[model samples]
Target: MNPPEPAHTPQPDVVAAMRGDLADWRQWLARVIVLAYAAAAGLSVVAFSKLCDLAQQGFASVLAFNPWTPLVWTSACTAGVVWLTRRFAPAAAGSGIPQVMATLDPAVPAEARRAFVSLRLSVMKAVLTAGSLLGGLASGREGPSVQIAAGVMQHARRWLPPHPGISEHGLLVAGGAAGIAAAFNAPLAGVMFAIEELASRLEQRSSGLIIAAIVLSGLMGVSFFGNATYFGTIEVPTLRYSMWWPALLLVLATGGLGGVFARLLHASITGQGDRLGRWRAAHPVAFAAACGLAAGAIGIASHGASFGSGYGYTRGLLQGHVDVPLLYVTLRVVATWLAVWSGVPGGIFAPCLAIGAGVGHDVAVLCGAQADASALIALGMAAFLAAVTQAPMTSFIIVMEMVGGHAMVLSLMAAALGASLVSRWIARPLYAALAQAIIARGRLAPAVAAPSR
Candidate 1:
């Protein structure tokens, strides 16, 4: 009892000890979060591979049909997607990136805030993405995959025990990075992407968690998918000093083109969704049928070059087996742009890859540099992704991991950095800017602002 005297006795050591314990707990929590992100990332990879297999099987089935049958199938699928979008969730249309940006933007209002984790959006996105794949749209599944993974993680937060001061935005970034890692089987790229593209801020503390999550996700993906490269093994080429000038030129041109494409895509798809909504409301089945018919016609004319994720075409470009001329690349580019702009549910990521490969192929042939087509294709990929997403480091690292080996690192770095700079000069970051526009237009209400860190 006598010892209980002096309630205000000095205890600097106790405070210091408490602070040390808190720091240790924070580190432990950070590790756990990273582990969770890795698991999610691994699942994302499995999901992407399954989707790819399904898409491939679907394409094979359609190809087995008579030429006319493909046309009919294309029309039917496109029409069904349009009807479903009009009926169920119009927000599910397009690349899904813009919607994601809108969802993440802090300026969005509370009541008007669309549920990022809504099961409805998930189901609709899956359905629309499958439809786009089947309907011969030139899109990828990565964007939808990103949305699905983000939504899943958002919903998962409810069950997670509350952490004293954890940020949901960080979780969302982790999920998105995992999604990309899973999709491409590239963990490092995903980590960089989380910081450069998704996270508005770049700092060691914030990046530490995201990086851990990305690595974990990538590891998980490899565990499930057998640690194979996304595009198989790539043959690295010898670099020559003479080729630098041509590579630089290719980077600049492709980067500028990517910026233009980004601008056009945003303008065409954003407010235009409402117009399609009105059209569908007035003539649902017929409008759907017309869209399907147009898709079929394009597919047939392009001899199926315009279908799916453009993987076949990308492969062809990589292998130096593109059967068509440069004009075909242009056609495919326009087709992809229009297909997505017209409200097809898919992603531009893969299509951009295809476009980049085509551009690289054409450039390589024109320059008469007997460089390995695959190397050129890889460079093109980095440049195009950098230009479109304005995430050069992410694009460069992702391509390197996807392609494997270090022979082409210098080329990739130069091209990606150049392309990113060129694109940035031409346009604002595509998704972030789009999110801001949506907020400005009152389409989405602002949310509680989170410090980017």
Candidate 2:
């Protein structure tokens, strides 16, 4: 004690270094958590989608599925799922893409955060979206899977210590891209989608995390599902001058039709369709039941062709294992609109893909293009998706990866461009418009959520 406590003091340099180390540790921990949770989310989506597929088929089989059985069951189940969504998780209603799109906006209101992105919303989406399919709503799990994965990553971000040095927008963007990559097993498309659709300009600091998450999540998907084209082995024939005619026709048809569909869908949801949209808003439950009944009736008319996600039918057509009648395409388009219009939790991606396949088959048959059947179907699916989402790069890349269409990349790119241009005449971009609606509703802004010191 006498030798004294000469100056027991910490060095400023050492102290500053310690603080920096702690900050870094916190951020790294958050990032690690994001990656691990993303993998788990991706795996869950795969399993859940498979389960939904099984449920749809099982319910159909048990009911003996006569014309009336499918009609009654599909309608009844639709009404039940709608009730559940309305009572428990209204946010879980509708395709979740719009909600995720809202997360990337700097001007988004703080109050809207819980409605659009949260752990609770994701779980409800998983349970209810699966339940909706079991009701034969003709939807897909792939789209909802994106919102679910984003929720997981968003929740995981909360585990970080205060001041983790990550931006809120960056976290959401990275999570979304990771989700898409994992869901489709298309990592490159994930990055492209984030760049094109989510953010206007992605800063260098945030890009690394985005890439890492996509790679990690995509690997997770690959590990669980095994490497395979989404619709099975697609036979992309070598392009010829003769095939160019069909390609051009497909681009125009898919782009125009897809644009019209997008505009109609937006109009219905935003109450821009006047009386019908107003009526829907006024009587949400009854409207949902009516939509369900319409869906059931359509399913019966189409002989169940308009049921589930249209995955099997589309894949069958592409693999040349089944013949697709034009009536099937019309019924699917009608079914999809009815389901989406009902304010039920569903996605347009798989249904659109199937519709496009049906369109392609019709085009091929009508035009007598024997050699370009596979190419036409691929072109339609890619082009229609491009037109609907307006993220042409992501659309083509995802279709390319899923269908193994690298040999026809030029054709695919052309189709996407054509579709995008035509779609522009139909309406404002879909996701951007929906995101703005969320912002206007919530009144959140960039200044509301400044980084905490």
Pairing residues by index, what is the TM-score of model 1? 0.84
Q: Give TM per candidate.
A: 0.84, 0.89
Candidate 2's displacement at residue 344, Å, is 0.5
**Candidate 1 per-residue C-alpha lDDT over 336-360 given as tens digits, one digit per residue, 9 for 90 to 100:** 7756755667787888887787778
Clashes of 2: 4
**Which tens-of-lDDT digit does each residue in 293-315 have in candidate 2?**
88888887886789888888878
TM-score between candidate 2 and the true structure = 0.89
Whole-model alpha-carbon lDDT for candidate 2: 0.77
Record all residue pairs in model 2 with backbone atoms less than 3 Å apart, i.e. clashing.
94-344, 94-345, 108-444, 109-444
- CA lDDT, every model vs. true structure: 0.70, 0.77
Off by over 4 Å in 2: 1-24, 441-453
Best by TM-score: 2
